[model samples]
Target: MAGARFITLFVILSSACKVNSQSSLLEQFVSADTTNRAARFAYLKKVSPTDTICLNDIKRAIRDSSGDSALFVFNVDGFSTMLRYENELAQICKSNQLKFKLDIGTDIGYVDQTTGCYQDYLDLILFEKYGKNFKPDLHKEANDLYLANHLLDTISSWDCDIRPRCLSANTHTSISIVVDLPIKAHRKEWVVDKKPMFAVYHPFMDLSVVIDKDGNTSGYQLVDFIPARRQNKKYKEQLLAIAIQEIKNKYYKWKPAEINGVLLNTTHVMRLEFEAAAISK
Candidate 1:
């Protein structure tokens, strides 16, 4: 009777070991997503052994399935806009009894511009499921489509007048100011050197001007000065002084900016480009 009891005990122990081994295999294959690295590791460690069985089975089914036959689940908040599409996908999976992978924290508000359909978005979700096994041609096609749509959107919304124009003869000569705001300057031309080597020079100055609520000009500061050509350092200083003085002599009658019916002070940076051609012959 003792020997018979010993053999039964051995059988029970072996069976228990086999079950434990299978549970470990399931745990190894199961994937989980959490808020952060530390949380994910902790969750993985705390997962119940029974849960591994279902997770492992899903992983196996996804691996063995072909094409769209594979199923997946996106673990997102039910209130999310993505729920509508995910629910439809889930139903399809149910019909096939195909186990699916989990997608965590997916944004579903994204819609296609051309087709206005979710089919393209669904394709992306499926591609993500395949991971490294996804076809390169399909991935490239998706990227190309995205770029083409982006280009179209950019072209449609582009406003030429709002774009920054570099200081050039065509743009600088035709300065556009607000109707009430007129800029006045004392002298547009400056003599760089008055000695044996006399040269007439024109330089570009970038100035920051501030207008108060009363339409009065308040602050004036030189942001930058670019000389038409390289000259002596002392000569450049004189040119800058002349430019600042000219800007100071100028006056602006601004229409004050208002917010909620109250006038507000505003600041603007203006680039003044002076050309030698503008000088009297």
Candidate 2:
């Protein structure tokens, strides 16, 4: 009886020591990123397969340091918007480092992850589900879909790098932001609009655009309107209608978003700031 009791105590102590050692390694990893600026993620990658403890520690550290507090706690909250918190966290991570990985750690539990980015706006769509996953067609243009071999999955955290949404990742890094570089489609380029007053009146609007797979504006609704100056009632009615008609006329000029070359019939909200030169028909 005494021998059994001794062995039990020894096991407990061993587990405690193991946990502490892993925690110590995590502290070093986080510290090195800040103080030991030379500690590369490549080095950590080499040690991850054999050292799951260190990898798991680093993974959790990434969450604790970068994960959204609301998402971790309020996943089921009725009034909060925190779906796909892991993707948001992933976005933050890749914003800092171009090529990175998450979920290298073993754990009792981990945040469920998906390669799809479906915001609340998609709730009304007639979607088919494969258990927790929706049809890949719905998410063909998601932000997370741009990663290398990305998937519209329902599983653990990113096994690969997570970067900007809808933007191609090759050679696109932090340096691109500071140069005023133009991005490809899915992001809009503005025009000089409003022929009535080339300098005096300015207007801006946000349109909730539903672009079909054919890259045409299937439908749209004005979400926001800001007119530089208030016009009379008749003019007000005509003004917004003209703006609406102007956008609808460009049906063939738009680009649809996609993933892995698969077209996505998704909704996009666009903000437009118009200059005096472009609004006239």
Question: What's the count of clashing pairs in each model shown?
Answer: 2, 7
Best candidate per lDDT, number? Answer: 1
Q: What are the C-alpha RMSDs, in order, of all predicted structures?
A: 25.9, 20.7
Q: After superposition, which runs of candidate 1 have C-alpha atoms over 4 Å from their true positions? A: 1-202, 232-234, 275-281
Off by over 4 Å in 2: 1-201, 232-236, 271-281
lDDT of 1 by residue, 1-281 (tens): 11221232233323322311322211211211111223322333343445443234344434545464644433332222122123333444555454444433322222211110111223334455665223233323333343333332221101111222222224334332221112222233445566343444445677666655555554666788665555423344554555555545554555544322334455556666554323232
Model 2 steric clash pairs: 192-278, 193-275, 193-276, 193-278, 193-279, 194-276, 194-279
Candidate 1 minimal-lDDT segment of 10 residues:
154-163
Cα lDDT, all candidates = 0.36, 0.33
Backbone clash pairs in model 1 (N, Cα, C under 3 Å; residues 3+ apart or in different chains), count:
2
Clash pairs, model 1 backbone:
71-100, 72-101
Q: Over the full model, what C-alpha lDDT does candidate 2 score relative to the true structure?
A: 0.33
User: For candidate 2, lDDT tens digit of each residue in 212-272?
Assistant: 5555654566777665444322243444555556556532344444433444455555554
